[model samples]
Target: MQLFEHNPIKIYNSLSGKKETFTPIETGYVGMYVCGPTVYSNVHLGNVRTFMSFDMVFRYLKHLGYKVRYVRNITDAGHLENDADAGEDKITKKARLEQIEPMEVVQRYTVDFHNILNTFNFLPPSIEPTATGHIIEQIELISTIIENGFGYEVNGSVYFDVHKFNETHEYGKLSKRKLEDLIHNTRELDGQSDKRNPQDFALWKRAEPQHIMRWPSPWSDGFPGWHLECTAMSTKYLGEQFDIHGGGMDLKFPHHECEIAQNEAAKGKSPVNYWMHANMLELNGQRMSKSTGNTVNPDELLSGNNDFFSKAYAPSVIRFFIAQSSYRSVLDLTNDGLLASEKGFYRLMDAVNLLEKLEVSKASTININAWRQSCYDAMNDDFNSPILIANLFEAAKYINQIKEGKETISAEDLATLTNTMNIFVFDVLGLENVVKNDSGTDKLTGAVNVLIKLRQEARANKDFALSDKIRDELAEAGILLKDGKDGTTYSVN
Candidate 1:
């Protein structure tokens, strides 16, 4: 039987404002969509926490034996700097400042995003779609909305008719906002602007002459709105109605709100079964703002190169730190919090490593079945990772008790405990065992040695071009390679 048969997971639906028993539209399959990053700059730690939350959700769902089609869309275009209808495209803005092509900026940061995710042991989504790649779909969606009378064209741009849509549909149901309240709060639109109301968002933006990321459309040569890409890509991949749609809590209004409007206008039905929002992340009790100089990027934290953290933390330690909090609660990350998580993370790993050395007794003293079920029960309750982690520590305590001869497990129960612990700790939690010798620098050393050996082989084969390229790349990463007559050795600065 599939593990999901007994799991019966519950998800807190942001749309419904309560936890609901999760029932996939398909019998044993799930369709999930998450809004990915706007790759204009290096991804911050907040983005990491949001993605990591969904990563844990994805991991747990798969562990329950459901075939999941997870689709996360990359906002390569159409993401304005202010996250609204009218501002410079973030990628385009970065390109102009750096004097490079917009796609160059996208490609560079997308690679960086992937590298960071890989370092933190994140599972790649089943289908990763890009916004720029789905422009045709977005254009078609806008045409459908316009034909359905929820959209109007002014000048060269198309905007969603919020008042018209509200007459027939609830404009802000997901955000739990009323159209009147939104209108009352919003300032009146000036006659000089193209929008009919301040609440009406852009469907297609009219590109200025200086805008380099424009695409040809029926209305004009322009780009899609920031919110339109998620609707287009999510609908195209996950269908008109899917299982779950997730993003940061900050995107609940306007970004996700506009997505609901777009999909409802075009598809004529609600687009998602469960709407999930991961809460915000703060650094040292304050909002992580770039202007205040109180932000810590993933690279900085991992390398101990920033002023925020006391020492270098491994990727798994950071991942563990994030998983300790509920996704719906704002997580305040401090040096002390990370330090506590570091100790806890190693304790869990250390217990797992000692499983093989544990001796089995004739009869079990503890209820292994109950302990295993407790872990499952914790996850089944809205993917409550903090509770699940607490259960993990319970088992760790049992392991230590068994090691000290204060507790005993039967051979059958020991096997069950070992398998269950492995699944939850390594597979479901998505944490890797740390190297005790170097506090996790051994992996980097092993990787660098692989490259050094490849460069040596290239030199032996008289491929100086390949050899020189390897040397130059390692030099850029602060890994100095000294190739003596004996062999090549490396040192990190």
Candidate 2:
């Protein structure tokens, strides 16, 4: 049976702006598409937060026994500066500044993005399509839109006729903006634009003479628009109507709205069944932006080189911090918050370790089944990770109570508790133990044993200073030594 059979999952659909029960298009499978990063620069922490949110979603769906085909596209081309569908292509601009090929810029940052996400232990997507690779599909889509009378070409550029599309279908339905309001709020470009209306975004932009990312198209030697890539790649991989489409909340207005218009105008159907948008991440109380000197990258946070963090934090701790809040809530990255999450992470993992050493009793004081159900209930309600974490901490407290003989569990209940923790913490939450294992090799084990013996001798001889030095120094080197009733043991932290 499916894990979600008894506990139905509910998700907040951004399209409807309400929580709805999740039902996949297929019974035993799911298709999810999320917008990947535009590889113009190193990904910021806000981008990481958005990807991490979807990573959690992907993990939980697989844990529920669903075969999920996840597609996250790489924007190697088509994305523009300031997302205005104007200005230079971001990759082309970066290539010009660096005096390198546009592909070089894409390759460098794509590798960096993969490495950083790998360090954070994110699962690889099933299909990672690139925008450049799907230019033909995008061109075909634009031709269909033009044939349908919703697109027009002017001066070698193709623009989606937002006004015409709105007459047939709602153009801003995803963003809940009226067409009149959008026209009123649209800002005029400085130079003369070929677009009929300020809201009519580009389907294909005519490449400027200096633009390095040009490709041959029906209109001109140009590139696809920023909004066209997701629509093209997603439909190719996940089909016409998929289960979910997701991106950051900032993309809702014109980017996603244009995508909706393009897809409907071309295919006469909505492309996605559910729309999910992750909320923004802030630094201290302000939005993270490089221009304002308020942004911190993942490398800076992990290395503790940025002014925002007090000390270096492990990747697992960072993942745990993100998991402590609901994906829909605005998360503030602060030193104090990270420190607290660090403490909580260790506490939960320590209890998990202690579970193995716990002795089974004749009767159980706490109902493990009830507690397990509560954990599932929390996750079922829109992936409410904060509440799930609260339940996990409660289980941790119970583990401690059992260790202290204040509570007891049967052999069956003990097994259930152990398995539940392992599944939720490691599998569903995508969190690994921050501490490393030092017991794989006899040589390392012997070295640790020698240090433990030397420390024991120092304590026995009343050499308190030497003993303190040995323990503190080892702790600095990621080896934590714990003194217990039996003897001294150590773990790599």
What lDDT tens digits, residue by residue, belong to model 2 across residues 1-493? 8786777899999999999999999987899999999898998789999999999999888988889999999999947764344559778888989999999999999999999999999999999999999999999999999999999999898988888888879888888899999778867765546778887878888888878788899899998888999999989999988998889999887788887788888899898988999999999989998899998999999999989889999898999999999899999999999999999999898888878778999999998999999998998999999999999999999998887788999999999999999989998888987654344366877888889899999999999999999999999998889886557767776
For model 2, what is the alpha-carbon lDDT of residue 62? 90
Best by TM-score: 2
In model 1, the worst 10-residue window by lDDT is: 433-442
Local distance difference test scores for all models: 0.88, 0.89
Each candidate structure's TM-score, on Cα atoms with residue i matched to residue i, is 0.87, 0.94
- Model 1 deviation from the true structure expressed as Cα RMSD, one decimal place: 10.5
Candidate 1 displacement at residue 491 in angstroms: 23
Looking at model 2, residue 238 earns an lDDT score of 93
Clashing pairs in 1: none
- The alpha-carbon lDDT assigned to residue 339 of candidate 2 equals 98
